[model samples]
Target: MVDLYTHILPNVEKGPRDVNAFLTMAKSLVDQGVKNVVASPTYNGQDLEKQNIMLYVEAANKHLQHAFIPLTILPGQKVTIHYRLIQAFEQNVHLPINHSTKYMFLQLPNENTDVLNEQILYELQLKGIVPIINEPERHPTFLEDSDLLYEIVKRGAIVQLSSDSIVGKNGRKEKKAALTFIDKGLAHIIASGVCADTYESYTLPKAYDMVSRQFGTQILYKFMENADYIVEGKAIFKEQPERVKKGKFLGIF
Candidate 1:
């Protein structure tokens, strides 16, 4: 499986402290059935940070080869939201998901998404870049009113739910939001946003089990297929997003 969001790179962002730590994390992911991991360290539009992450990816891949590990680490960045996001992409500072340049893992602020966020997503789409919002379930704004998420998805943005969120690692609110996203067909992919520190509780197998139990196997397959689409830089399959009807919040159960 393709675990699209990870901080497995050594000494980059809040990931593993050293190469040894990164290798351990990679081994754990491989053990959890992850074959392709996108090394998405956080990027705030800094050139130095981007360079450092690339270096870490190169070093990590070399070690994987030496260790004969079957895991393949791909280059990516979890870009923080900013008004000049389109400009960063134009300047080639922002690394897209798997270096595809067509799909990017974008982080939205916890606050309510305003016109500016929509504008950035619109501009990114204009340039052939699809912004996949990372873990919207954890954001307060989304938890407050899920219709906002449907709006974003309607405007050509994809929503990526964290694997841990589905399994209740993030808490009750996030879990509810995640399940709601699946029920409403707003979530396109489920990624193991496993960092170096949180592997035991956030395993991909557990996440899949939780999703299958709650949403069924067909929804699980859609998420897995979407991950492959992202890796291939192709458009993901998105069902028409529907808002949660009043008094139907418990329908997922």
Candidate 2:
């Protein structure tokens, strides 16, 4: 499977600290049956950071070949939804998934506001970039108001749900939200490596098996296909998202 979000690059978020640490983390993903992973460091719109991301991706891929590891690491970032991201894009930085200018992973903080909400996403869409927001299931703002996410999805943003969250590794609230997103057709992709601190390396694979059992293969296959498309830089399949009731379970068991 393809993991669209990971911090396997050193100095990129809390993935790994050094080359050795990176290998160790990558090995964990390999052991979990993940063949490809996108390295998502926390980007802040700097040319130097872009260079470093490219540098680490090349170096890490070489190391994988030299060490006989079969896993491939793709280049990507979990860019914070700052206003400057607009300027950065205008300046020619392709903050996209797997180096593809079509899709990009843009993250919103807990305290999301108007700037982080509709405006930037609309702007990105105007440029033909489909912004993929990671783990809205765990965001306090989104949890408090599920319609917020529906509105964003209606505006053309894709949702990437965290596997561990759906696996109930984060907490009950996160689990409920994660499953609800899938039930409502809001989630377009599933991935791991939200953070090294919450790393239960096996949960991603476990989540797939368990979710496929509980929710059926239709939902499972859609997100899985979307992951592959993101890596390949092609258009992904998105369901017509159904709006969620404020306090109901939304049919998610």
TM-score to native of every candidate shown = 0.93, 0.92
Model 2 C-alpha lDDT versus the unseen true structure: 0.80
Q: Go through the candidates in order and give each one's C-alpha lDDT.
A: 0.81, 0.80
lDDT of 1 by residue, 161-238 (tens): 988888887888788878888888889998887876797666577877888888789878888888998988877788
- Model 2 C-alpha RMSD vs. true structure (Å) is 2.1
Q: Which candidate is the best by TM-score?
A: 1
**C-alpha lDDT of residue 89 in model 2:** 80
Mind sharing the TM-score for model 2?
A: 0.92
Candidate 2: stretches off by over 4 Å: 45-48, 194-200, 249-252
Give lDDT: candidate 2, residue 198. 49
